[model samples]
Target: MGAHDAGTAGRGRGKRIVVLDYGSGNLRSAERALAHAGADVTVTADLTAAAGADGLVVPGVGAYAACMAGIEASGAGPVIAERVATGRPVLGICVGMQVLFAHGDEHGVVTKGLGLLPGGVTRLPAERLPHMGWNTVTPPAGSVLFAGLPADSRFYFVHSYGVLDRAALAEAGVRVTTAHHGTDFVAAVERGPLSAAQFHPEKSAETGALLLRNWLATVD
Candidate 1:
């Protein structure tokens, strides 16, 4: 076999995709989930690792401010931004996605996000503190993320703050959302080579696993 054919037979062909460790994320869980999804994931806060990655996943499970602080402090912030700018898929989960936006308004804190997305995040109405529960999404007519979904499969979610009414991102290119807090929050989004979810796919069930699997297929 040729050298190129030999290189094609492995988990992502050792194509390291840095899993940003901002100290505010569930790094191990995300790492395991990605591995299970058939991609070799490397958890790192190191700036150098970012350069080696073919794609990147910035997973987080904390306040946006704290996570941003950790990313900048670790010097992975600018690197991640650079990665995203180069058209590498940057999968951000929950708070991670929030940080990709322009800013976030949570806990009376108005902090700047990575400015990758076009907008900012806002706190949910008083009626719902944390939009916790299982909610299904119906992705728009044509979406790459839900390419093989069963048409009504539900994904797990746990969060309160959201971008806005019905959908969190207008420029996200795709629309997928879940009913929550008497409104709709972006369950997932895909724009060009980038995609993100507002829920923890690692903790989610079969549906989540499938989601990660689909995402890994986009690395090339």
Candidate 2:
């Protein structure tokens, strides 16, 4: 059995999770993975259903600016902010996580983010353009998202732009997780009911499943 299958042990049963459809992301894959993790999953653009769910997941792919545009066009921006303010559990994946930050600078064009988290997203200081494949992460002490996972456990990553500084987030009492591409960049972050990952857990197989299970455990 996979680590997720063994570790989750049906922990996600009965939890209602809404995968926010803002016109981006691998929606079906995320839905399937969450259901396998044991949550009753819903993929929809309906704000009411999203807001009422036990947990909310924001998934994104493609450029940072395009994802932000989708989030804005779908009218999910306010709902996401409200959910965070009300202490409801919300998870962002990939560019979904990036949009939660203050801004994203792609090439020279700067786009504003949700500002829920501090800092901006920029190209990694690496020779490679898109840092694809698997890498291990360094989760801070007391990380709920990474709890009980192996120290050397690797997660899938496929992005170039990322938040590099950990100081601002740490000062805000957010637990930061770091992984290296060319330099250390934010991998995941957890604070209160808000959590985000730079990698796609759905595509990550076992390790990703366990991470989703962990996030589900935090949902009320």
- Runs in model 2 with CA error above 4 Å? 1-7
Cα lDDT of model 2 by residue, 17-96, tens digit: 99999999989999999998999999999999999999999999999999999999999999999999999999999999
Model 1 Cα lDDT, one tens digit per residue, 87-200? 877789888877888888888889998887767788877476687877777677767666666877877778878776434356454455555556666677778767888888
Local distance difference test, candidate 1:
0.74
Pairing residues by index, what is the TM-score of model 2?
Answer: 0.97
lDDT for position 31 in model 2: 98
Instruction: Give the backbone clash total of model 1.
Output: 0
Candidate 2 residue pairs that clash: none
RMSD (Cα, Å) of candidate 1?
4.8
Local error of candidate 2 at residue 72 (angstroms): 0.7
Q: How many clashes show up per model?
A: 0, 0
